[model samples]
Target: MSDFWLDLGFRANPYAVRALAPTADGRRLLVGRDDELAALTKRVRNSDLHPVLEGQNGVGKTSLVAVAAYVMSQDFKEGRSQQLFLPLGEPLQMKDDGSELIRDVYFAIAQAFIAHHDDLRAAGRRVPRVDDLETWLNAPTYRSSKGGGVSTPLGGGYATTGTGLNTGSAFTDSGFQTMLRRALQEAFPGNSGGFVGTLDNLELLDTSSSARRVLEEIRDPVLQLPGLRWVLCGARGIARSLANTPRLNGVLADPVDLLPVERRYIESLIDARVHVFSVDESGRANTPVNADGFGYIYDVSNENLRDTFGYAQDFALDHDPAFFLDSSPAEIENSLMAWVDNLAEKSARDVRLQGRMWRLLEDLATAGGTAAPGDHDAYGFNDRTHMRKNVVELERFDLAISSRDEVDGRRRSISLTSKGWLVHFAKKRDLLGQGALDLSMTNESPEV
Candidate 1:
């Protein structure tokens, strides 16, 4: 693997699909998100409520949060910002249980304190209680002979202890809350600033109601925690749903709807990654996919950076590297078209549509690729019931996904999937007409 990438003139695969880190290299590679970065930093800097972020899956939500947090941290440390915000290492995954989620928050806080201990100390923001939490966190990795008295339990009894370098004594729920409060007061001193953490993928909670309940249950304990700023992210309207919770009013900020990167910036995004991951001293990297090739992949992915990178990386590995390094631009273009067309063709065959579903798919794509489910007439359906059946079928085949608005119960948004975009591309670019993909058996495929 090393030699494979090295021969490609890269220290590593440039298009690997992962969240951009909260670091200098990640910041440099992050392109076309200046407005979002600025807005996020400003929102974090000025607002008391946690920002809610809503976007299509793989639209760079995590990376945006990461880079924004990094910038804020750097600004504060360099005296460019008044409020000091150290981003937690990564977004905390929301859990089903309230207690477990609360514990995760404290654990993440402890981890950040340990990770940035020297920086905090140098800034004169020493948090002794959090330092103790850090010590307990480091137990499995290394042990010290440090000892302390048992903390009194909330029920007015002696808490458990382990005599030396104890991991259990200070790990109880009451102890975590007490120490965290103390840590927050000492480190932030009444909202001066605190750890910038994120809770991601609330949509995975199985339902919006579940997410709301979980958040509400921990609202007082977690959201109200001082010295902690949070950004909560979800897809498919989940973030917006959380924002609308009456019980959580004033706790979550307005949802930041993240759209796909503008088409104009797609090329620079590719080039920036190419340059950032380059290994050659002359800065000439052997890129299998150029800007134009990447644009096509991006289009097929509906502008999803994660999917585009995955496809590009997979294409490079699935075939000989020389095909890209040695071939002409025309050859590369032709090869990519064929590759994507073939994938779409395979996906199309997997979709079971025996009637006029092809026309419905075409209509959906022509209508800007998204529509409200009630607008069945606009989608060429005779009635809502028929359209709904087709919607379920499309969803089952992973070609479209639908989201409901619970408050009104009348508004719902259904959008085409990335695979559906490939079919759209085929039809629009004459690939289907040219027999590049045999879509006779089925209409289209989508990811739910």
Candidate 2:
């Protein structure tokens, strides 16, 4: 197919499915996050505790952190702030294996050193010795079998266990860990703050106890490092469980809960990106999804910015260019809504959920798309077993998903899948058309 974005006067697709990078252009494209940016900047700069960003999946937590770090670097560059904090290119994915996590993180740090070498030099920061890092990183014998102790590039046979590194060094922390700290010290000099790095996707661990265990494992090796300020991002209840963990006390700050961007700002958000990615800065650009249409999709996606963007792009591309180029804004919105309606109908057929399963889906949507398994009672479910049977049916159809946490002795966490939300919203719109819906009786459609 021909490129539709160019026909719309954009240099690129504004709704591309990627988080905003920590760059000048990315900052401009980021909108409606000023308050969040400011609060995050403060937490990064002044607080000793690592800031945790807690939100639903794809609510732009990564974007918020990246932009905040970029802005801080700008402030420092312009002499408005006292320190420079280089943002790593991407958040480190929290790992289950201790050695692997340490090795991978140090490699990332080594790369950051080279990537920001110029900035460090300009700021009178000492760029750490790259030769050593390069040699070690490129060494043939970086590791051995999982059970064996870690091997060194120098071939000194360095190994690490729960206790610490065992080699020539008597240090509890490994030589690799020591090297990482020293590199950070060289980059920032004295008390200039440090690299603003993020450890993301704690929820992928699936259970709160595992999350806590992994975090505690890295506490001394990574989190306690002096020259790295951390922002931890998580979805589900991982942040909540970590917040309550006694082992992480004084280490992690109370999470900054990130709610979805209000639909009121949709236009501004689109306009900002449209201008940024336009073929000409002053030229008119076509954004096919009107605010109402985009808002509807955004709501149905449970305010997941990533999925919402994906849907918008897919919808735009699924149709011909003339559909957008020849249509009025109102006409375009109607078509988009119809497209989503067709999707919902297809999902309804695909799931083919029974009445009880549908009832459970509705309760989940009503619970803001996430609730405890115990919440089944409130949804008129007879008991956990009855709820489980229905939820399993929903899961089997890919309509609902659940997670368990070691916290509170296995908290039953369940959430509606994207399809489930679409199914729920489909029912909602139908009821609204019939004038039978009671809650969220606003003239505007509600976020289910």
Candidate 3:
């Protein structure tokens, strides 16, 4: 069968929003992050401090990092300054002794060094000490049984082999750090550029003291290195958790928050993506897909870039492409709401938090989708602790948005997100018939 994306006239699956692939060209299809990108670029160029990027899921934290890396690489190409952005393959897993985490970090840096050298050589530039760096990075190293015994060559004839080197001992060796630094310097070959290590999904780090201590030990000294900058990205909850750790006081700079893009920017994003996939008989690019379909998607997705692309892609696959060109707004909206309803119903079945979620949604609906923090008491949550936990859960699931009330200025409130409202309305209408409590006053959608 033909692939759905190809059938829809896309050159590639434009909605394939994985962590920006490492080898991908940095010219990403991004939208509405100009200010954030500028600030990130400045931080990377001007400081060696480890900065944290915090945001809700799907707010494009990974994309932001990719663009920043691309910009820094451009700077190097254009003779601005030298700072190679080396993103880790994945976020470090929180471990008990920190040995595994450190080992992974070391391996990722080594791989980046190798890639940079390969790139330089491919461009006909002289990369001095390339042989020495490859030898060191590929040297047989001990690995714990848990580390597995997979060996893979990471380009340029260098292969990382698991030769039974003790994971803890290898990192503890006094000369490892020095050797790694020397190899990095050799690869870059001048004081012009340094290395920026981009680590995403740091919210995975365990909250255990042992884990944090290990993180601090491995992280703090690296920040002091004149040529290296570490950028950690994760959700806001993790940022708050890390902020309270006494040992991490000065090690972490203020976090850069990636907020939601405006509605206009989201519309532009849809247009941009549609243009990428649309083509004429001459094989030239053409106008975007139906504006009505795009607007309906924008409204349903609440202006989230990830969801906008996802719904648009799904809409294309579910109906004939011809229908999409002149789609009805009502038809598209109804289809989107149905998709959202199914998603919400499945999500609400989470065994751990189902009861609390239903109750919280009920309260939000009763309050017209917005309620002060103190409103939980009227909903059978007697104390702030219980209410706060449920609110956190709601935020984690993207079901509720907690923000300061604009009218009241100083008071914080919790409100149903678009998805949340859909699910709440469905339950009130007895569509799901899950026997959920109906605390709402009317069937009308909330003012939000």
Candidate 4:
């Protein structure tokens, strides 16, 4: 037999988690977020505003921000604009005193600034580091009241004790703002525009009072500064929770929701990766392994791009290059079931309240995959609050999808995704060895 896999194009597994879809030279690889990119670019260029990007986990919010940064960098290189892209890596954990949170944000920004300069120098660009900027960012900002006197230093370096500023209260100081403005000018010589600061995973702030307060304070005053734009990325839950915060009402523009890619695009994405290994000897290309199974995989994936890629990877793994040419339908189904089983096992391990979650899933499956809010009591939930918490947990795991509707009155309906249903049923029949419960009359209202 010929070395079929060797003749293919990819050097490694194209469907690996770290694999990114290829883009044209000098462009960023971001699929299915054109509208969001345009809105972010315009907002950054035209206004001093804070924009929130909201989406589900694995829906590509970070990718969108990275693409925006790439475009901004390209514009800067070509002299179209002088917008600096400062990416704040992750959200600050909530603190009771709020001092640590503020200090961390500033420290993260400083580090990103330094890292950006490093990249520029590595690329052979002639950009000089400003002494004042380095001094301000490297100095210690605050001291903790603990016995050891922990100090908050900028950019991972300690500063002289007497020279440090108190970060807890220094954020609003005019002197700090002046130094920052001058620093920007020194950092980017010809750039008239200011900096764009991107904070990914902003949802982490929602559960912390201190973090939220810091964010609110920063949102109002920081945007008022010339040329600075803050883009916050998080889930829709954070946006809704912050919607009514008085301080943030007018300061933050409407959030840009990153919706899922269209079904066709998702199929094309799978095909693109598979096509890399589908070439035949005659230079003619054939469908990669198990093209017929894609539809079933897509259905199981619920059209989520990341999940689709995962299923494709599972298919590829099962049909090894040397052994099998393509996976049969039975093999594909077995692979999918195994994937679902693995998800359930992982979920069970990660979730602290695994017992409650399993019960909820069991109840959901017993209810013909759908359950109304009023049916919580029937599912052995102690109260509506417990049920709500379990729903959030399930949603977090992407095992359940909920929607609000007005049938007689406004009520929320919850249903298990295909994976959820499969896992629940599989556990009942195979894993846990529990017999299946009848679900035919699940639509009828249970007696209170």
TM-score of each: 0.85, 0.86, 0.70, 0.61
| Prediction 1 global C-alpha lDDT | 0.74
Residue-level lDDT of model 4, residues 48-158, one tens digit each, is 457777665556665666567667766766777655544434443434444455456555555555656665554343333444446656556533222243322221123
Among all windows of 10 consecutive residues in model 1, the one with the lowest summed lDDT is: 152-161
Expressed as tens digits, the lDDT of each residue in 232-345 for candidate 3 is 776524554454467777766677777777666655665555555554334343222344555555554444556665655664566655453455656655665666556546
lDDT of 1 by residue, 1-448 (tens): 4376777888888998999999998898789999989999889888999998888788999999999888988998889977788888788888888778887887787788777777777778855544445556655621222334454211112243333423433344235566556677777886578888889988667467778889998899789888888999887666765686798998999898898889899778878888888896566987888889999888777788888999888888877767767888898888887888877666565555533666677778777566665687776667667777877877787878775544422333567888777766655555453232444445544411
**Segments in model 1 whose C-alpha atoms lie over 4 Å from true places:** 129-135, 138-148, 151-174, 371-386, 403-413, 426-448
- List, residue by residue over 115-187, the lDDT tens digit for candidate 2: 7878888888776555544655565433322344544332333343222333223222345565557668767
lDDT of each: 0.74, 0.75, 0.56, 0.52
Q: Evaluate residue 203 in candidate 2 and report its C-alpha lDDT on the 0 to 100 scale.
A: 80
lDDT of 4: 0.52
Model 2 segments more than 4 A misplaced = 131-174, 409-412, 429-448
Q: Which is the winner by lDDT between candidate 2 and candidate 4?
A: 2
Model 3 residue pairs with clashes: 82-193, 141-165, 142-164, 142-165, 143-165
Candidate 3: Cα lDDT at 228: 58
Clash pairs for candidate 2: none
Candidate 3: where are CA atoms >4 Å away?
21-28, 82-97, 118-174, 186-191, 206-211, 220-226, 241-246, 277-304, 318-334, 341-359, 362-385, 388-431, 437-448
Instruction: List residue ranges in candidate 4 displaced over 4 A.
Output: 1-9, 18-28, 79-98, 118-182, 185-191, 205-211, 220-228, 271-295, 314-321, 324-433, 436-448
